[model samples]
Target chain A: MKADTRSGTGDPMDGFDTTIHAPNRLRICALLDTAGEAEFAVVQEQLDVSASVLSKHVTVLMEAGYVEQRKAVRNTRQRVWLRLTPGGRQAYQAHLAALRAIVGP
Target chain B: METDEAIRPTPQQARATLAELERVQASTAALSATPWPRWFATVLTLYIAAIPPVYGGMTASTQWLLPKSAWSTVLVLATAGYLALFAFAAATWRKKTGVALRLDVLPKRATLPLAIGLPALLIGAVVAFRSTGQPAWLFAASGIGAAVSIAFHRAFVRLHRKTA
Candidate 1:
């Protein structure tokens, strides 16, 4: 997380996490924050992005330790579910706060 | 090299990002609000409504309906069946919406009271019926339980929309 020194808003950027700053990654965090957990295919569909594109962003998030994946066998098929780690959720929330601050009331 | 100035977004960019995030959240909310199958509510209501009478039957002095031993079995089967139905509903919802139905998503302010009040109502009714030997207590509890289940379903849909 980086402080938004540019704005001089002392405490506002405390949650500004650059790891979640990318557009698709931000959207992913927003969805996971709301849903708690969502299937990968569902996320890909909801985001309306190619699998490769979504996977690329997901890999970045995963590497950042912001998101975790769960693999399960359901309906005789393997399914991957994605959710934010606790730290990831905290970082995402902080980023949201920072964004709101930048946007003002 | 990306300068600090280049790394930070301007206010206008922040506003745009916030708007887009809201759009994504709204879409997720809409998906979550997908209506449960009609039977979901029906089964839930039926299960809740059945608890008191079934419990009363198990503990009642009179054994006219079934032997005292049989009521326990009935209660267990009923509970197992309800759990199975609940699991099925959750699985189907996940398949349909690609999002799992999560009770934790609901506001604790609302769910906490429900978690406590519902069981209290049903169990209280059972205790009253056993002490008084009145069928009316069981009937009243059943009706209220069913109504509460229906109302909760409606409230869940409304809450999702309001949050969205």
Candidate 2:
């Protein structure tokens, strides 16, 4: 799909790139992007955040319909598996576009 | 296809958006300076396999000549050294791979091999640990260690075979 050339202020950056922002969120997305799918604990460990903090942020994005979190059992243990939803991927790309715009070609 | 309602940012908005792009690119670059896996299993293979023999030697060696205190101290020191080396190797591998050491994050699909593996390893460890200073324990440990590596090898192959 083609990208919208608009920004939060309804102005065209002309060549804006979209990228997901927020330090922890960006890190989480980066890990997920590379790792394919990872357990919640893996993301938490990589981000070095406590469970509650991750849960909070994850839930926020999750509620926004950005990230996908699934429940599964591994090694007979319950695991919270995470991946980026298509919507989330789009949002990330859009954010990345915005970031690219900020850098100006 | 282009949607009619797709928003078009004003030049100023586009310029501001460019700033976002800059920040993310830099952040991602900093986040992953190197690509690494959760567990760097390569370097661990050495002491990991060597453990059977080392532990076996400690158990079976004829200690009648040396003082009990000195032998025990030596054994402890050797084990400590092994651990230190393991740590060093792990660190180096991490630096090289840009991946963190994460054993728990192993693929859920790999549980079968792991399930098949843990028993084999446990039996080997039990046999080795239970041996009454017998050479047989070393052999048992060796066999178990081999089987475990084979199982782990299968897992690694499965993971590595996936196309990027």
Candidate 3:
């Protein structure tokens, strides 16, 4: 991940965690942030990624305490729902702000 | 393999990323714009439009025919029915939209102006009815208000989707 080293603007780059800087990870965060929570399959379908690939990114997010998962039985089938933690939401918002800052006025 | 660390975005790339993110958000929002809610909102508006007359008719028509307590019970039941419908519609909406009720953009857009204008218009109608003893005017005003609100909602969705 590229560190924000621009010294003068002081746009709070500290909130931009490297964990969420990945392109796919950033997209996942963006989706969850807006949807609030979504079924795992729904997220995968929306992102158009393989199950394994989605799981890998989700695992990274889970490890970082940025995401949580719940399992439920829907139509007699187990379904996983994914949502961002409050901390995750804060971090994502801050990261978007950092991105905006990087893009500049 | 190009890992995330190897794929840092330049300023232009960052702009593209943000644009994509915004597009994603917009698409998610659009998913929630299904017709069920629109129809429900229209019905709810019409239901609200009917409330005054329904309650007034219950009391007026039943004044000599039934006990006062019975009137209260019927009014309570009618009000409860409306509340139950609202709750059912809201719950169904949450399920179908896969987003919380607060994130409902159409209602949010329609509500702000409606919230401000609705009370004033309703109160004005009430004042007019009380002073003039004409009940039809109140129903006419509320019915028109409800229709306008539905029209405004459709217009907002149409414009919003066009922009999106």
Candidate 4:
């Protein structure tokens, strides 16, 4: 995993985060960014991906320090909830900015 | 070896990625906009409306309407019932939409004021009623609280639609 050195200043490309650029990871960030915190199963359903596949992407994001998970019991079952860390949120936003810059108006 | 040029997305690819992001956002927004259960709104409104009178009765020096003992029971029951209902609503909403109910999603500017103001308004009414021995203050506050509750619910729904 590469270090995410997204300096808030400088060219938009400086903020482009490779860790979050993968399509599945990008979609996960978008959903968590909007929803705040989502159950792991919920996220898997939204992405229409297998649990193992979603878990793999989530592990990559977690290793990058872009996402965190919470474990809790709900309805007599253990559940995992995922949310973006503040650093993660900042990187995601910056990545979006970089994408917009590339796309232009 | 993959060069920087090979790694970075071209403008066309960026555009497509952005479009996909927009689609994800739209779908998530739509899911989040799932309407609150009708009973949830009605019960919440009634709970808000009941607060002032219940507190007023609890604090009244003279037994204004109900005995102090009864007021205590009402207070306990109402609070417990409202909390249970709130938990049920949140759980059901999550089950239905795959999105958790989140206060942080609400605009902070609007939510902060309501968070502070609603309690202040309701408690203030109780205090005023206590000092003056007037039930009218309680009734007035109840009406205002109920109206505010309804208005906030509608605003939340509107916000979800607009975001979607």
Task: Please tell me which predicted candidate would have the highest TM-score against the true structure.
Answer: 1
> Each prediction's Cα lDDT score?
0.83, 0.55, 0.71, 0.84
Q: Provide the global lDDT of candidate 1 against the true structure.
A: 0.83
Segments in model 1 whose C-alpha atoms lie over 4 Å from true places: A1-10, A74-77, B1-5, B61-64, B105-110, B157-164
The per-residue C-alpha lDDT of model 4 at residue B11 equals: 90
DockQ of each: 0.47, 0.07, 0.39, 0.41
The full ranking of all candidates by TM-score, starting with the best, is 1, 4, 3, 2
Order of candidate numbers by DockQ, starting with the best = 1, 4, 3, 2
Judging by DockQ against the true structure, name the best candidate.
Answer: 1
**A31 Cα displacement, candidate 1 (Å):** 0.5
The local lDDT score (0 to 100) that residue A100 gets in candidate 2 is 48
Better of 2 and 3 by lDDT: 3
lDDT string for model 4 (A11-80, tens) is 7666677789989999999999878878898889888999999999999999989999988787798989
Local error of candidate 2 at B135, Å?
A: 2.7
Q: Per lDDT, what order, best first?
A: 4, 1, 3, 2
Error of 1 at A36 (Å): 1.0
Best by lDDT: 4
Per-residue lDDT for B1-164 in model 1, tens only?
11233566888999899899888988887777766778988988998999888888988978737786787888899899999998999889988888867666556887899899999999999899888888899989999999999988888778667755
